[model samples]
Structures are given as C-alpha cells and as structure tokens.
Target chain A: MTYCIGMRIDRGLVFMSDTRTSAGVDNFATSKKMFTWCTPGERVVTIMTAGNLATTQAMISLLEERSKSQEERDPSILRQSTMFQVARLVGSTLKEVIADSSPNGQTSDDQFSASVIVGGQIGEGRPTVYLVYPQGNFIEITDDTPFFQIGETKYGKPILVRTYDKEMSFEEAIKLLLVSFDSTVKSNLSVGLPFDLMVYETDSFDTSRQKRIEQDDPVYQSISTGWGDALRDAFQLLPSYSV
Target chain B: MTYCIGMRIDRGLVFMSDTRTSAGVDNFATSKKMFTWCTPGERVVTIMTAGNLATTQAMISLLEERSKSQEERDPSILRQSTMFQVARLVGSTLKEVIADSSPNGQTSDDQFSASVIVGGQIGEGRPTVYLVYPQGNFIEITDDTPFFQIGETKYGKPILVRTYDKEMSFEEAIKLLLVSFDSTVKSNLSVGLPFDLMVYETDSFDTSRQKRIEQDDPVYQSISTGWGDALRDAFQLLPSYSV
Candidate 1:
C-alpha cells in the first residue's frame, strides 16, 4: 500500500509520496517513490509511483539508463517537448517494464500493475500533473480536477477535495498536503514516513525545493499534533444536531 | 456503492447509512439500507448493508420472512439471546441468500458479495456493534475499534478515528456522522442522501431518536456547510512548512 498525491495549483505544482512498500504485513520496506529528472531552465519532471515495487524500480532505472544518452530506442524525459509527452513516455515505459517481467506474457495479475503520477513544467508550458494508469494511458489535471492521488487514496481525499484552492500559496499547499498525508498515515499502517515532497513553481523548469520528512521531523510533528488538536476543536464547534 | 457507519460509544450505539444505490453511474436510485428489528424494551437490532443491493435486499427479506413465524426454516433475530447471535443469524442468512442466488455452486464472482454492520442492544446485553462479512464470519467492535464502516468507507474514516470519543453525547455522535456522510456524498457520486440515522442510547431498549436526513435538511445543511468552512479555517491555522 502507498499514498501519493500531486496537485496543479495556480502558482505551481506539488507532489508528495509515502516511502513505505509492503508485500504483506511482515515484508515491508522503505523505498523512495519520488524520482526526479531535470535539465535546468528547460524541463523538470517528478514522477511518483505506486504498486509493484520491482516494476516501478525497473521503470525508473530503465528510464534513467535510456535517458542518459538518447538513442532511437530510448529518449530523455528532459528532452520531452511538453509535459504531455513526458507523461506518455513514462506511461509507455511503465507498461513496457511490467510486460517484460510478467510471466507467460500475461499482465493479468495485479502484482504487475502500477500507477504513476507525473507532474512538472517544460520550457514555457504550464506546470501540470498527470496520473498515468497501468495500461500506459494518462490524464492531465485540469481546474475541475486540480489534483491526482493514487494508492490508499480514500482516507486522505476528503480534506483535499474540501480545502483545495486554485490560488493558495505554495506554503498553504504544502501544509494541506501534510495534513492529508498525516490523515492517511494514521489510518493505514502500510503508508508511513518518511514522506517525499517536491514544490515546483510554475515555469521554473528547475527542481530545487524538495525535502524528505522523517518521522521525528519537528516541523512535521508540530503539524500533525496541531492538526489533530484543531480537528477536535473544530469538531466541537459544530452545531449540535437536534431531534 | 454505499456508505454506512456504525459507532459504539459510551452513551450507546449509532448507525448511519446512505440510501442512494447505483449499479453504475447511470442507474442510481434511492433504496433504504438501514433495517431495524426491534421488540422495544427487549432487543433493538439495526442492520446496515452495503455492496450487491440484490444480495443484501434478498438476505434481509429472507431473514424477515423466516423470522416472522419461525416454524423451522429460520430463527428470529429478535429472540436471539445476544447481539452476537443476532449478528450470526444475519451473517448466515446473508451467506445463504447469496449462495442460493449464485448460478454456480462456487461464489467466484464479487457480484454476489455484500457486507453488513449490525448494531444494537439485546435485553441486558451491552450495546455493541458487529461487522458481518459476506463469508458468514463476523468481527465484534472493541474499544480499540470503536466503529465499523462498510463499503466506500475510506473517505469518511479518518474523521471518525480522530474525533471519536467514548463519552461524547449522542448529539455529538450524530453531528460527527453527518459530517462523515456529507464528505462521502461530495466525493463519491454513488453515495448520497437521504441518510438514515439511528441513535440507540445504552439500555434504552428503544429507538426514538431515529431520523432520515434529506439533502436539504436545515441541520444537515448547516453541518455540511459548516464542516467545509471549518476545515478550510483549520487548514489556514496550521503552521506553514518552511523549506
């Protein structure tokens, strides 16, 4: 289980991913789900994946191998002319990796399934977020759908849907994301710290604002405790239901 | 999809279920999911079902028919000595109906799957809640697990886990449940109003505070709007993450 969320707000884009991966309750490990590629001032793509660990790792490594020096068979994400093309490249590469590892030419098993969220900016293109499905298809975020969440998504979604604003500052967005992640981590054991977060200002085309939040991170601790306290207070403030 | 939540707090047990049932986005209709079998001053058992509407309805009807004049076909849930027995009766009845409806002897397809949350007080038995699975097995709610939510549950779960108090008022419980349902209704198209809510005060042996909350009810409206506003306000109160 995992929880990764990406938002395309008016000011920029935000991506957050939990690091825990598990085959079962007993077999659990921490793996960085966020992968970054940047050609400063040209393109910056941050991809977060959920599902089969090997497939995602293979996809990222394969992309890295091919993108190092563009050949006809493999191309660089940094060279993708637009975010849409980057998403397509990531989607196709994910599909290929899963297919290559599937036994008996069958991608039928969910063990081979994986989903990716690609969010970034390319040159003058707008910053955006795309949710790439396991079947090598993807959909970009729009104003109506300002964010995308994959893996263990339900527990953390209501807060996002309720408070997401198009014009909120990046600080506000990060705070909101932390609250959402805190809710998810508390509810699901499979999703836990440390969390990876990336904030990309629109058209920056350079990846610099990124952080790995550990369990004891003071900032995170304060936010988690503060949010819980606020929720209790907010819950109490609601008008009591009358018969 | 349906969203039903059963909470057992110090005061008593509370059950809330959404009425909207949908086979697909296009085929949605209102159907009551909350069923109550109460011999007031004795036992008041309320069951909320989610998943295959046919299976749930059939199971409920079968239990009603067999329990009506139990000559041998079935036993009365009202006469059950304990809430656990009532839950077992409901679970077995559910399993039996689904098995009878299956085209093949095997329960291979999930189309026949359904889950139920049964909560109430039987005579002197303490107010309790049990989650009955489709496979005829059930788990009773413990203090550590004060609530059970079946189907489309994730969206509304975090709030319950965070705000639930063992000694909160029934009014507070109802308010909390409505907030949960409101969040679920807004996020998922398949779950909607009107919502059936039953507040069972411990040892009361009566359900006089039952209400069916509609989409435009004033109290519901205030909670829904108030919750959204309060969440946004709370989001603002959180400390911003400094990079």
Candidate 2:
C-alpha cells in the first residue's frame, strides 16, 4: 500500500508521497516512490507510483537506462520535449513491462499494476499533471479536476475535491496537499512516513522547493496539530441539534 | 453508493448515513440506508448499508420482515439479547438475501457484498460499534480502532482515524463525523446530500438527537464552509519554502 498525491495549482505543481511499502503485515518496509528526472532549466519531470513495487522499480530502471544510453532511444524522457509526450513514453514503457512479465496475458493482481501522477513543465507552456493509469494510458488534470492521486487515494480525496483550485497560490496549494496527505497518514497503516514533497514553480524547470518529512519533523508535527485543533474549533462553531 | 459512519465513544455511540442511492450518475434516487430496530428502553440497534442497491434494499426488507413476523423467527433482531447476536442476525439475513439474489454461488468478487456498521448499547453494557462483513462475521471497535465506516469509506476515513477518541465528547464526535462525511460527499459523486444523523447517549435508549441534513441546511453549510476555510487557514499558517 502507498499514498501519492499530485496537484497542479496556478503557481506550478505540488507532489507528495509516503515511502511505506508492505507485502503483508509482517513484510512491511519503506521505499521512495518519488523519482525525478531533471535537465535543469529545460525539463523537470517527477513521477510518483503506487502498486507493484517490482514493476515500478523496473520502469524506473528503464527510464534511467534510457537516460544513460541516449543511443537506441525511441523518444526517451530526455528526448521528449513535452510533458504530454513524456507521459506517453512512460505509459508505453509500463505497458511493455506488464506484457513481458506476464506472457499468458493473465496479469497478477500484484503484477505490474501501477498508477502514476506525472507532473512538470517542459518548455514555456503551463505546468501540468497527468494521472497515468495502470494500463499505460493517462488523463491530464484540467481546471475542473485539477488534482490526481494514486494509491490509498480515498483517504486524501475529500480534501482535494473540496479545496483544489486552478488559481491557488503555491503556498496555499502545498498546505492543502499536506492536510490531504495528513488525512491519509492518519487513516491508513499501509501508508506511513517519511513523506517526500516537491513544489515546482511554473516555467522554472527545476524543483523550487523539496523536503523530506520524517515522523518527528517539527513542521509536519505543527501542521498536523494545528489542523486537528482548527477542525475541532470549527466543528464546535457549527449548530448542534435543536430537535 | 452510500456513506455511513459509526463511532464508539466513551459517552455513547453516534451513527450517520447519507440516504442517496444511484445506479449511475443519471438514475439518481433516494432510500433510507439508516435502519433502527429499537425496543426503546431495552435496546437500540442501527444498521447502515452500502453497495448493490438491490441487495442492500432486499437485505433490509428481509430484516424488517423478520422483525415483524411471529412464526419464522429463529433469530430476529428484536429477539437478539446481545449486540453480537444482533450482528449475527443481520449478517445471516444478508447472506440469505445474497443467496436468493445471486443465481450463481458466491465467488470471490461475484458475491453480493454489503458492508454494515452496527452500533448500539444493549442493557447495562457499554455502547459498542461493530463492522459486519459480507461473510456474516464482524469485529468490535477497540481503542486502536474506535470507529467503523461502510460504503465510500475512504474519503472520510482520515478524520475519524486521526481525531477520534474514547474520551471525545458527543459534540466533538458529531463535528469530527461531519467533517469526515463532508470529505466523502465532495470526493464521490455517488455519495450525496440529505444526510441522516443519529446520536445516542449511553443510558438513554431514546435517540438523544436525530436530524436530517439537506444540501442547503444552514448547519451543514456552516460545516462545509468552516472546514474549507479552517483548512485554508491552517495551510497558510505552515512555514513556506526558505530555499
């Protein structure tokens, strides 16, 4: 189990994911889900994955291999000039991996089934977020649906659906995302910490701010504390039953 | 789809469920997901259902019939002396309904699955919350669990998991529940408006408070608005990027 959230706000984008992975209750462990491929000032793409650790690791290795070889590359991450094309490349690679691992076309439920939120800017266009499905197809987040979440998504979905806006400030976006992430962390034992967060400014082509939050991280502790208190206070302010 | 939340607090128990049912986005309808079989001063049992509208409706109908009938009564809800027995009664009824409905035998995914959260106090014992599964079995809420949710549970789970407590006041419990429900309402279009809330105090067999919340209800409006603003305010209060 994993929890990864990607938001495309007016400022740019915000990506956050917990690093916990568990095969079973006894086989629980941690692995980073966020992977970054940056050419700095030209392209910065971050992918966060949930489901099938082996599949995701393989996909990441393939991307890294392409980045290294540069030759025999069929429109690799570095070669793809647009975020849309990059998503397609990643999706196609996933499809291939799934096919190779499962020759009988009977994919294991625990096979290469992963959904990714791929977000970044490639040129002077708008920052974008695409929800890459397990089948290697994807959907771009529009203003109507300005966020994409994968893995233990339900826990964090309510916050995103109610609060996400295309015009939210980067600061506001990150905070909303943290509350959403905080919600997931509290609800699910499968999704634990430390969490990885990256906030990118539109057209900057580099990670403007990135932080790894541990369980005892002071800032996260404060956010989590304040959020609960504020909710309680706000809840009290609502009218109780009169009937 | 439905959204029902049940919490086991030190003072008593609180159960809330939205009454919306839909086959698809277009075929929207309303039904009572909240069912109460109370003997007034003796016992109070509340069951809320989610998944497969026909199956859930049929299960409730069967339970109601059993409660009303005189002869065919091996295990009736009103006759069940303990909360555990009551759960067994409900689960047995569900199994019967599914067997009747599904022409095929119960396969893994094809089984008629309806999740239920049953919470109430029986006689002198403490109020308890149980999450009854499709297999006619259930689990009680411990200090670690403390709450149970059925149908579209993920969206509202974070609040319950993080903020719920055995020592929480009834008022606090309601507020936390509303926030959790609000989250569910926003994320899933299938789970919708006009929520039913029933709060029961430990020694009081009669409903301490019950209300039906419409979409335009002022208190609900306040809850939604207040939670959103409080979330934004909380987000803004977080430390911004320094690098």
**Top candidate, metric TM-score:** 1
How well is each residue in A1-243 modelled by candidate 1, as lDDT tens digits? 899999988889999999999999999999999999888878888999999998899898877875455555443676688889999999999989888877666355557889999988888888889999888999989999999999999889899999988999999998999999999998889999999999998877777899999999998999999998998899888899965
Q: Give Cα distance to truth, residue B114, candidate 1, Å.
A: 0.6
Residue B183's lDDT in candidate 2: 80
Q: Model 2 segments beyond 4 Å from truth? A: A66-75, A106-110, A165-169, B66-75, B165-169, B207-209, B241-243
The stretch of ten residues in a row with the least summed lDDT in candidate 1 chain A is A66-75
Q: What is the C-alpha local distance difference test score of each model? A: 0.88, 0.79
TM of chain B vs. native, candidate 1: 0.94
C-alpha positional error of residue A39 in candidate 2 after TM-score superposition, expressed in Å: 2.6
Can you list the residue pairs that collide in candidate 2?
Answer: none
Candidate 2 residue A15 Cα shift, in angstroms, is 2.2
Residue B56 displacement (Å), model 1: 0.9
